[model samples]
Target: MGERVQTVIVGAGVIGLAIARALAQAGREVIVLERHGLIGSEVSSRNSEVIHAGIYYATDWLKTRLCVAGRKKLYPYLESHGVAHRKIGKLIVACDQEQLAKLSGIMEGARVNGVDDLRLVSAEEVHEMEPHLACTGAILSPSTGIVDAHGLMLALRGDAEAAGAMIAFNAPLEGGRILDDGIALDVGGETPMSLVADEVVIAAGLGAQDAAAAIEGYPAEAVPPIHRIKGNYFALSGKSPFERLIYPVPVHGGLGIHATLDLSGRVKFGPDVDWDAEPAYDVDPARGEVFYEAVRSYWPGLPDGALAPDYAGVRPKLTARGEPARDFVIEGPETHGVAGLVGLFGIESPGLTSSLAVADHVAALLGYGKAQ
Candidate 1:
């Protein structure tokens, strides 16, 4: 028999780390099994790192609730813990009259979703805020910001470890069996081992579906189809043109390719959605062509050959191609008939913004603590 733990969280990404912290803080014995040698090596590090303001989601969606709540919870924690971050705000621009009219609906939807701080600004205001921007109108989201994601993860790991949560890096979940009172997991690493966990949470970002399938006795029908979309980011060679983040109105399958700044005020444009079969992190040079056209829509002064491939992140979408995006699917015993197992699916954008709330929800689903 292998070691027995009160809880075993698969994946040590932000959400997994947050969940470990929450559960460990609740006096539960937690062990985080990470396939990679370091935490945040996958989806956690490969993201826009922007803190969303819960504006784009529907009124009743989990993304809206968790993102808003998580953003609210995150700012204070980041400040209190001395995490580097900036609430520099964001601008959603509309270049044409048709797109400009869509801004109202976006604003209305944001309001319905409890994000009342978003304000519609005229073309003059947009230009005043960002002279290089050429939009007819814009929606300013004051609550949106950027954060040092790795620093935040370090804090979460510290908290979890302080609370007795043990993180075993390089221990990938190979497969598992659902035991009578708990689940057994086969973990692969430098030294292979087996573990029996009273509770299990599959928060594997891109590997979520595979993690679910690895668990024996899990309902096959409950596993949703996954679609992978590669979002690539491009770095600017010169000084950033704008102070605040600039985003065009959303497009099919994603928020349009937008420009965002890091904590150091360096600008990068990205994440143009490219459907793919497998995960690819390479930033193709040819893809830079599309970014120039996209960025020029908002900033016409963009210089040719100034854009270069920077980094890329893959979004594991739960919705199929051409299908409307779906909500965060957090399945617990109620859905799978498996006691003490929860799987997170379709946690893409707003996931970083919603990490804490997602953790609280997952912990509450396991009957550990209240989601606040």
Candidate 2:
């Protein structure tokens, strides 16, 4: 028999670490298991580390709710913890006259989602905001921002550890069994071990479906299909052109290849969508042409060969191609009938922003609170 803990969280990503901190602070004996040698090496460290403003999702959606709530908590948490971040804001631009009308709809949706800080700007105001930009109109998301993701994760890890939470690296959950007393996990790492815990949180990003299926009793029908939507990035070679994040109207699968700046003031664009058969991070140089065209629609000043393939992050989407994007699916005992077990699926964009709030939701679902 392996050691028994009050809670075992699989995946030491930002969300997992956040949950670990929350549970440990709640006085629960918690352990975070990660497949990597370090925390946040996968989905947590990838993609645009933007602090979303809760503008793109539906009003009733979990993304909107958690993101709005999480963003509120994150800023203060970041400041108090000395995590590097910036509320630099963002602009969703309309390249043509036809697309200008879409800005109003987007603004309305954002307001409905409780992001009332968003403002629709005319072409003159758009130019005034971003001098080098080309757009008929734009929506300024005043609360949009970026963060030092690594620092945030490190702080979360430090807080959790301070609260008596243990993080076990290289610990990949191979399989598990649901039992009466608790859940059992077969953790594979430097040394394989069998561990049991009273509660389990499956916060695995792309591997969420596989992780859920490993548990023998989880409902198969309830496990939605997972797809890898890979978004590629390209870095700018010259001086940074924009101060704020610049975005085009969202496409069917993603928010379009938008301009995002790191804390260092370096400009990078992308995460243009591509469905991958498997997990791969190679960025083809030829794809730069496509980026050039897409970005040139709003940023015609883009110089030839100015964009270099930077990095790529894969989003674990719940639905297949051509289908509408699905909301974040977090199932607990009440829904999946798995007592003391919770599985988080399709945690993509705004996930970083909504991480803390999501942890609160998970804690509530697992009956971990002051009352408990």
Candidate 3:
């Protein structure tokens, strides 16, 4: 709004908004610029709002660290704010002997990642926990749950606004250039205007790389290539019979098709992995055929036509096809020699759970201490 502020955060997704709140809470003036009319319109609003238990990632990686730490921070925040959520827990089911072999490895991974309370359950115990689920073995994650993502975002916005952070909607960042004075932003629109700031944090999610390209002197190589990975969901029409979230053994690149329950107890299954170069968000009802087969593997009583196209989300993956998946890339001035600027890429799964920790990490990059 004014000529300048202490910081400018690009993108209004959960990550961006959370970062803005953290910075403002640290007593720095902040402004969040969003291209959409409302916040969380992109990856934030689309994904399964599952709070990931620290599993499937290497112990030392940022994904594992942030997810574990953020979960500790988020649960209390949600409860204190009156946001709708359920600690419904989750089960990593083993459909057969081959899958059963992998359960031990998963438990070891979870333990090393500082996740306690992950216990291996036998077929009998699984029946006791979920009578309708068909499985030979399972790993119970009591900390995993779901949140009303939109509601969580609203609370975050309220906190940020209350702390004096300003947000401008429909304000797409056109470009920017680093100067001796400060960083200058060219916000594109009918009333295109330029503003300066001491520091800029780019939390643009899928658009992070593109936004980085717009800034002169920012290295192209430093901006990781953005790959869009599509995940599809199917909503169950009938009342939910299951009480907790159900998942499959950890699969490379994703947690396989599983059942998830919302705060209202509505059941849904989905987010089967599909990679697309151009990336389409539309959910194809025909995919329900595939979902039916997957869901029936664990729940035999699923009725026909009950599973319908629910929604879809695209992951802002940093790796390309045939390449190994990389951890979160939060490039800052030290990496690219662009002072007062930071870029976030590949903030995908577990991102929702890792939102607060990610915000703290970004703030530290800008030389701000953790908010007390």
Q: Highest lDDT: which candidate?
A: 1
Write down the lDDT of every candidate, Cα atoms only: 0.90, 0.89, 0.87
Worst 10 residues of 3 by lDDT: 363-372
- TM per candidate comes to 0.98, 0.97, 0.96
User: Each model's RMSD to truth, in Å?
Assistant: 1.1, 1.6, 1.8
Give the per-residue lDDT digits (tens) of candidate 3, residues 116-179. 8999999999999889999999999999999999998998899899999999988889888877
Between candidates 2 and 3, name the one with more favorable TM-score: 2
Per-residue lDDT tens digits of candidate 1, residues 99-135? 9999999999999988999999999988888899999
Candidate 2: segments with Cα more than 4 A from true spot: 276-278, 369-372
Clashes of 3: 0
lDDT-wise, the better of 1 and 3 is: 1
Instruction: Supply the TM-score for candidate 3.
Output: 0.96
Clashes of each: 0, 0, 0
Model 1 residue 301 distance off true place after TM-score fit, in angstroms? 0.7
Clashing pairs in 2: none
